[model samples]
Target: MRLAPVSLSLVESVLAKPVLDEKGMILVGAGVKLSERMITRLKQLGVSSLYIEDKRTDDIVIVDAVSDETRRSAVNTVYNSMLSMIETERGARRASRPQIGREISRVFQDILADLKANNSGLINLASIFTVDGYLYHHSVNVAILSTALGLAKGYGQKEITEIGVGALLHDIGCTKVPQEILNKPGRYSDLEYELMKKHAEWGYEMLREQDGVSLLSAHIAYQHHERNDGSGYPRGLKGDEIHEYSKIVGMCDVYEALTSKRFHREAFLPHEALEFILGGGTALFDLSLVRLFAKNVAVYPIGMTVKLNTDETAVVVSLNPEYPQRPVVRLLTDEYGRRLDSPYDIDLTKELTMMIVSYNE
Candidate 1:
């Protein structure tokens, strides 16, 4: 199967992966052949891409770093926790804040276990989701990405759990912000922007009051926006003033936000998002964390199409864990744009002369 943009062309194609809801339930299951109506609905739901069945790439498989069960549980946990917090704030019901913290921590352990058992040692968060589910999915993605970075840095289990929990709840403060501002499709006015920026302090206050949440973890919510050069919000902490855990989560948060399709703009491809992160190294974010992120993330995810500098087109077959920028690709077309009768695979790390020029063809 291969990843393709959602369009009329997918009318007769079968879905290779399931499209999930905010609750982590499968809205459309795999192996379901799509109709024009289904495709139209997907586009309306803000789905920009889909993994469709293709005999040519039948052997290609895209693996998630975490298991399906774990992912479902994580999303559900985040959704419930955030909703409960929001309701509590509105005086709708009394919520056990400590219990919320404990529940999130438990789910983080499951996510950590899955990441450790994953042999690929690379992160792929190209899951299909609806726009309404963005916050729930984004929380889980950030946690997974941050945990991957922690493992790459050789952090112990305790440290990993701390950072993982912190990452999972980094945006908890946003629950306090008005729904209009949070879901605004365009730029924010100055007053709206100021209100938005207060989420960090709000989140810190909430998390710090939870019995199960650590002070260090609460600080992650507080300082995740703090820049390495003292340009970030809430506090102008520079250099070593920002906690290392916050630095890790901050980078992952930016990368996840960029790669996700939004109301205002199309999602940036993995490679394009990486360039943005690289460009901000040492200025907007910690340089060391940015380098660590670029190393572990799959710039060109499996089953993604690319046009090589050789004027050939190929599908990424697998990741070269040590060099994510260079993946193993299976050629699909020659320079002349003719389909090849016999497609062949090449490892970009070995073929140094060839490079990917464009993707999503």
Candidate 2:
């Protein structure tokens, strides 16, 4: 059935197996019928065609991109499972459920496959938005990023899965805190901040009790915020004192948090967030891990329109992995921002006079 605003809930309920075709159209689910009103709405919205599950609507479905159901499943599985695990641990009994860990790992693997497939494109940064729901979305993004970094660093699949599981449940301790504290819109009082810091302790206690969970998993919850300079909370371990896995997760967590929007503060753009992290030197995170992340992640991904140093306008077409700060762009318009029938890609770092002035939504 056609959807007006493309509600994810409705999509999951109605479409069992939607697919995207090569042409970028959505395929409808099998054995489902669309109402005429829904069809009208889709047309009004300029969704030219969609691919359906069966051969009947094959022409409509185009690109086999990620489906809303897949996205929702990923979000819910991560969120609800973590909540249950944390709650179980808080009671002082074992909370480690091998099933939960496996589930989280499975979802993470799926997300990583998708991201890697579309690596250089406009990253589906939507996963980082907490606009409506929280916890699950953020966890999924962290898992994907951490896994990506691990993959780029040549870690084996087994180690990546362990790290991915750890990243997903790192914030499970937040479940023990009151909603008022977790969702506080402004700075917390000292008392509240103190309580907040206790999450790490709470998380560690809970994970320690669970069966089949690794030491690294619990350690991540306890150490994600610790800094290399010994300024981090819970423990003041300095320099090489912090575990290597903890250090990697620490950098990933902060990067994800800075890039994510919250009720408290606006999310920084990727470039701005990375700059802040880099500027911190080795004070806030592992310098080597931070540098690796900066190299791999696309700061200004494709499909994002941007302004150039020469006051001209362009759209990113690909990345210069060696120098993430300098990406190749397609000159789509002039300084006046007029459209061009054809665009040419330019390497901004090689072009001495050109820099990215700003990014466009």
Candidate 3:
């Protein structure tokens, strides 16, 4: 059933997932196929952007023209901001600049402030794709996620600021790796992989040369990938041998990488990524920290739809902290084929009779 063009509010209330149209309307069910026409009409109506559903009605289509002049300009601006941050940091390494560390600290502090302020303009980083501005954008995401993880653990501002600094510079070693090897679209030779591994040592040397900079922050670049079972790179330090901060950073780093698209592979869905991390456990990560992250993070965030084990479909209306993976859902229909309110909260964990089949991204 195709839908008539409706207001964004109407779409939000009725749709099972976030609709993607460039126009201000929500297309429902079979009506979703008309997204392109909806966008054209919305543009004619002076709407800036709109959301729609995937062809299968399982995921939200966030429509933003990569080629749109206005969006392109914003992409460039954000990308440049990330580049400038990384470049200044590199310059700090070469000059052994004291101010760089403080500046890094300040930037992190600003992000925390903005997060706490519940900034009206802040977009959920999870919903946005990092393809347009990979490195700089990835850095920001890591810092923000890591910082949030830190705060959730009751860290003081000083410690949180330090974690932020560590996260921002955690990939400094990547700078030393040859661009040809780093950016290779194809698989690398063993020799190339060996060269890539040296980034840890290179990053350590770069940060060590600076005065008054925290050594732990520098270590994060080298140690973030080192696993708890001694299977990772460089030193291969085993459980407890890895620093606490590095453990947290590693969890965040891997999570970000799994969810992000790379030249090698498309990003995994968040739940699938979480499953991979869970499999790693004490072998690849600290067990406790991994659980903490999984607990706090949204496995299926807002605007997602899901299939219930009861042979019914539903939308994720809210998160259930006590059961992070099994969120409260609004059932579209009961097993007997009856409709209900759009915002019902059925806790799946408690409903042992039901489980989430798959999430609608």
Candidate 4:
């Protein structure tokens, strides 16, 4: 299946994957042919892209970082947990641990098992979510990613668990803010920005008192925004002052937020987000953690089309760690604009002169 922008015209092609709502419910099932009415409804609902069956890319299969069941369960667990937190009265902030705590713990365990099993492959991090569906999916992706990076950095099971929990709840403090401020379409004003920035400390205060929640986990919420150079928020601590867990989670947190679509701007693609990280260097994020993230993430995920410096249109078939910017691609059309009779593969690592010029999302 090919991942491409869908419009009202492609009503005849069969859906390669199911279109799901924010709550993990199906909007359109896989193998269902779309109609004009269906396309119009999807567009109205803010669906910009769809996985459509294409004969040219039939053999290409895109793998998720975790299984669909795992992904859905993780999202629901987060949504439910946050919902309960939001519904609580202001004075009762230290109420009993909502059901989401136990539920998300189980979800993290399941994620660890899946990651260990499929550790060999590149992390596929694409998520289907509308702009308003933040926090739930973002939390899940950050958890899985930070855990993977922690493992690659030689962290043990105990350390990884702490990191996973910390990563998942790092943004739990966002619930403390008004939904209007959180979901506003424009950039935050000075006063609104200050209020929004307080989420980290607020989240820390809430989690620190919860049963079964560790000090490190609570601190993750507090310190994930704190930078190595003491340039971060709340209590800015430099170098060793920032915990290793926060370092990992903080790096992943920024990556997920940048790559994720938002109300104000189109998401920076994975490669673009990584480039932003590199530009920051160790001033804003830890250098070691950045290197670990670079090692694990795929810049251009499989099954996405791209254009090369040679002016050929191709689909990413595989990733190469040695050369992330130069992936193995299956050419759709030659430089001369003629479609190939039999599509051929090119390893950009070998074709030293060629590089991906544009991402065709």
Candidate 5:
């Protein structure tokens, strides 16, 4: 399967993967042939890309670090918990429900178990969701990415849970913001930006008051925005003053947000987003954690078509666990832009001189 941008040209293509809703339910099942109407509807839903069945790359598989069941359960849990908070703030409910912290903690335990079962240890967050579900999906993606980073950093189960739970509810304070500001399609005004920055403090206060939520976890919400150079918001604590867990969650938050398509701008490819993160190392984030993230996350996901420095075109077939940035790819076209009759594979780790220059060409 190959990942292609959603357009009218894809009307006849079959879906390689299921399109999921915010609740994790399948809106369109895999192997279904797309029609003009379906494609138009998908575009309306803000689906920028789709995995299309390609005979040449049929063998290439995009594996999620966590299982479908685990991911769905996590998304549903986040959606309900956050929605409940939003309702409470609006006075639609008497008060925010109790046990939110405990509920999220339990869901995260399942996520951890799934991650441990996967031997790859590399993360590929390839799930497709609509723009409206961005908050829930973003929260879940952050938790998954944060959990993977925690494991890579040699954290124990207890420490991993703390970071994972914190990552899950990091943006819970957005529930307190007005819907108009939160859902605005364009950049915020000066005053609106100030209100937006208040989410961190609001989230920290909300989480701290919840049962089963630790003070440390609540602090993750508070300090996730704080930069290592004291350039971030809320408190702007510098260097070691920010908690280690907050730093991890904050880095993951930025990465997830960048890679996700937003109302204001197109999503950055994995490699592009990683480059931005690496460029901000030490100044905006902890250098050590940034390096760890670069090592563990897949910069080029499976099935993505990329142009090589050698002027050839190839599709990433698998990841190099130890060197995720250098994936094994299958050559699809020659340097002269002619399609190969029989494509061959190349392990980028073995061919260190060759590199991917761009993707989705």
Candidate 6:
């Protein structure tokens, strides 16, 4: 399907792609026949829409940064580990350190292999979001982006693995925060905000105590909130005082947050989010990492309908790695809203006079 807003009755014709739960477990999978019962179950879980591989866009594969299995597996591991850390903070017994570390390493390996396999380097995470699975999904996105950045920075495999695992476990301390505070739909008051900022240090201390966990890995949790110009939270360390891994994860962390949907406000479009981050520049993030990040992400993803400045409407057909703002698109209609007899593809990079004006839907 081309991501149309189909009703429940229309849902019967399409298959259910893998739908993940809050804990990152598969709630539904591809090729499964859809039924009224399944649709009802999905609605009960707060899922209002889903991706299907229907004939309309069957050829338009949404290339994943990692496999569905890999992404879900990583999400599940992070969710479970975060919950365990919360339990421990509440007086429960500590779990095996070696086991947790091993799981982190294993996830890193799987993610690393897939990242290398993806030619575009740019990752599209919009394909896998769940309304209630924001925390775990955010973890997976951050890890993916951080790993790609490390790869771009010429980090060795071992170092990249460390960065990946560190980014994955960066928000474990959020589990200790009050659920209401965590899910607050509006800005936090001064006292609530101060408590919220404590998560970074809490996460670092928790990770540092674990056997087999790397000190640098724990530092990622500690220092990810610190900014390049000393404007960030917890310990307000500036510039080189922030660890390299922390800087990378921090940049990814902010980008993910900006692009993600929240109850209080709508999520920014990818290009819009990038512009916001670019505004921060070296003041809020490492400038070099910011530039590299812009390269390795899709501003306008495949399958999105957009209006062009030349008075035409089209669907994004292909991504241009060198020019993310200009992708190959298939013309759907003319400026007068008349259907075309034969829709043709235009490489926006070559057609320099035309530009995307707005999202059609």
Clashes of each: 0, 23, 7, 0, 0, 1
Candidate 4: RMSD over Cα atoms? 2.0
Q: What is the per-residue lDDT of model 1 for residues 112-146, given as tens digits with 9 covering 90 to 100?
A: 99998988767887578887788889989999999
Report the lDDT of model 1 for residue 257. 94
Tens digits of per-residue lDDT for model 2 on 200-309?
88877766666545777778888887899999989888878887777888887887778655657756667888898898888888788888878766676444456887
lDDT of 1 at 117: 92
Each model's lDDT comes to 0.89, 0.64, 0.59, 0.81, 0.88, 0.80
Put the candidates in TM-score order, highest first: 1, 5, 4, 6, 2, 3
Clashing pairs in 3: 2-31, 19-51, 19-52, 20-51, 20-52, 21-50, 21-51
List runs of model 4 lying over 4 Å from the truth: 6-10, 36-48, 90-93, 336-338
Off by over 4 Å in 3: 1-93, 114-127, 210-212, 310-313, 331-345
lDDT of 5 at 161: 90
Please list all clashing residue pairs in model 1, or write none if there are none. Answer: none
Per-residue lDDT over 49-84 for candidate 5, one digit per residue giving the tens place of the 0 to 100 score: 888897888888788878888888899999999877
Worst 10 residues of 4 by lDDT: 125-134
For candidate 4, write residues 27-47 as lDDT tens digits: 687899989998888766656
Candidate 3: lDDT of 140? Answer: 59
Tens-digit per-residue lDDT, 1-361, candidate 6: 4433324664565653677777777777767777777777776554545565545355676777888888878888887778777767777666546677888888878989998888864676644455568788888889998998898889997789778888998988887788898888899999999999999988898898887678999999999999999999887899999999999999899988887766556566678888888899999999988899999888887776678997898877789888999999888789888878777889999999999987663
Query: What is residue 244's positional error in candidate 1, in angstroms?
Result: 0.6
